[model samples]
Target chain A: DQQVKQNSPSLSVQEGRISILNCDYTNSMFDYFLWYKKYPAEGPTFLISISSIKDKNEDGRFTVFLNKSAKHLSLHIVPSQPGDSAVYFCAASLSYNTDKLIFGTGTRLQVFP
Target chain B: DVKVTQSSRYLVKRTGEKVFLECVQDMDHENMFWYRQDPGLGLRLIYFSYDVKMKEKGDIPEGYSVSREKKERFSLILESASTNQTSMYLCASSSVTRVSYEQYFGPGTRLTVT
Candidate 1:
């Protein structure tokens, strides 16, 4: 069974608009969530992460909201730029020091002008 | 900055051949992981090591083995290459520091088995 899932395979958004990507996980034991962005032929880079203790965490233009009760989390990118186009993956771990991370299938985001 | 480097960016091998993929981390990380990325499968862990000479099986470990003779170098070995094993292999390493679980990934190696 897939513990973490990204139902949408892809998403398209207009530049300067808000882009929302959703992730759902079945494992309730997960306490740490993270998002990573990947470009073609490149390795995934860390984007943002939120601990289960908090409901939300925000960076400059990116925000990750976690609804632990709903077993869902969403990543919001405001003022999406063309440079933001890439594959996004959401991952979950049991704790902060867990070595294993369960990752979602990933959502490909395309921001157009 | 933490840097993970893979031995090859691309490799092609024939069936039944023994294949080896190497990974090295610049930072003194205690944990290292090897994952294979396939279409619609995200990243599946093949193997991982938390210390020198200690290895653990991940979600998938069949037909694969790992070696961690040193703290910074980890090797993934395929006993016999199979066509189904063709995929992109990614290497990652993370420190055992508190409050930090971010894993640094290498460029990845695209392996093809024919």
Candidate 2:
């Protein structure tokens, strides 16, 4: 069973606009959520993360909103740049000490000029 | 910066052949993992080791085995390669950092079983 799911397979946005990516999970045990951005051939790099206690976390142009009741989270990028084009993956873990993470299928984001 | 390196970028093998995929991490991390990525399947963990000479099977360990003879290196072994095993393999390592619990990944190895 897929504990975490990224319903959108792909998304498109114009430069200087906003981009939103959504993710859902079936396991309520997951308390930590992370978003990773991946280029074509390189490994995924960490972008931002949020804990279950907070409803929203912001880092520069990236913001992650978590809703425990809905078991859903979203990544929002303001003033999206062309360089932001890449595959975005959402991952979750039961806790920090657990170490192992369950990742979503990934959403390909394309920022156009 | 944490660096995770895989033995090969691309590999091809035939059915019934034995295949070995190696991974090495330079950050002196205590945790290492091996995962397979497919189009719609995302990343599925095959095995993981928390320390030298220790290993644990992940969600999908069928037809595969792993070894962690050293803390810096982990190996994934396919005893009898099958076409179904063709996919992108990734290696990752992580430390016990207080701020982040994220794992660093390698460039990935694309294996094709013919």
Candidate 3:
């Protein structure tokens, strides 16, 4: 069973516009959520993360919002740039210190000019 | 910066052959993980090692075994490879400091079983 799911397989947004990627998880025990960005043929790098204690976390142009009651989270990138185009994976862990993470299928975000 | 390196970027092996995928991390991390990525399956963990000579099975560890003789190295062994085992293998390592629990990943190894 997939504990984490990214319903959208792909997303496209024009440059300078906002891009939103959504993720849902079936396990409510997950307390820490992270987003990673992966480029072609490269390893995924950490983008942003949110703890269950907080509803939102932001890093520069990226912001991650979590809704614990709904078991859903979203990543928002304002003024999206072409460099932001990549596969984004949302991962969840039972706690902030847990080593095991359940990852979503991923959403490919394309930021165009 | 944390650096994770895999042995090969792409590998081709025949069925029933023994395949070994090696990974090394330079950050002296306490955790190392091996995962396989498929088209729609995302990344499925095969095994993880928390310390030297210590290992634990992950969600999908049936066809694989792992060894961590040293703190910097982790090895994944495929006893007898099969066609279904072909996929992109990734290695990751994270420190025990619990700083957002971020994992540093390798470039990945694309293994093809023929």
Candidate 4:
């Protein structure tokens, strides 16, 4: 069973525009969600995350919105930059004390100049 | 600074040959994980260890085994490699922080079975 799913395989956006990535989950027990960004050869780096209690969380140009009723969440980047182009993975876990994280397939974001 | 390093960034092996992928993490983390990444399948966990000598199977553990003899080292063993097993393998380590499991991953091992 895929507890976490990123339906979009790829996305394209213009520089200085907004870029949004979506993710959904089947497991309701997952209370925490995270976003990871990766370059071509490097391992994924942590981006931002949100808890179930909050509807949205923002950090710099990155923001995460969680809709518990729909079991869906999304990442938004305002004024997307060319440097932001990379693969983004959505992950979920019951809690941070546990190491088992369910990751999505990943969405490749291309910020076209 | 904490670091996770894999023994190989790229490896090639013949079918049916035994293979070993080694991962080491500094920082005395209590958790270590092994996962494989395919084109569209995403990151699938093969196994994870919470402590030395203790391991638990993840979503995809078939045809594989793991060893955690030391807290900082975790090894994944493929008894009989197959072509279908060709993929990018990743290792990660995490500390059980207050309410989150933020993992740090290695560069990854791209294995090819010929």
Residue B12: error of model 1 in Å? Answer: 0.8
What's the residue-level lDDT of B61 in candidate 3?
99
Candidate 2 on B75-97: residue-level lDDT in tens? 99999999999999999999866
The parts of candidate 4 lying over 4 Å away from their true place are A95-97
Q: Cα lDDT for residue B27, model 2? A: 95
RMSD of 4: 1.3
What DockQ, on C-alphas, does every prediction get? Answer: 0.80, 0.72, 0.80, 0.76
TM-score of candidate 1 versus the correct structure, residues matched by position: 0.98
Worst 10 residues of 4 chain B by lDDT: B95-104
lDDT of 3 by residue, B2-105 (tens): 79999999999999999999999999999999999887788889999999999999999998999999999999999999999999999999988866779899
lDDT per residue (tens digit) for residues A1-113 in model 3: 99999999999999999999999999978999999998877888989999899999999999999999999999999989999999999999986439888899999999999
| TM-scores, chain B, all models | 0.98, 0.97, 0.98, 0.96
Q: Rank the candidates by TM-score, best first.
A: 1, 3, 4, 2
Tens digits of per-residue lDDT, candidate 1, B22-114, equal: 999999999999999998899889999999999999999999999999999999999999999999999999888846568889999999999
Model 1 residue B68 lDDT score: 99
DockQ of 2: 0.72
Model 2 lDDT vs. the true structure?
A: 0.93
Compared to the true structure, candidate 4 yields what TM-score? 0.96
Winner on TM-score (2 vs 3): 3
Stretches off by above 4 angstroms in model 3 are: none
TM-scores vs. true structure, each candidate: 0.98, 0.96, 0.97, 0.96
Best model per TM-score: 1
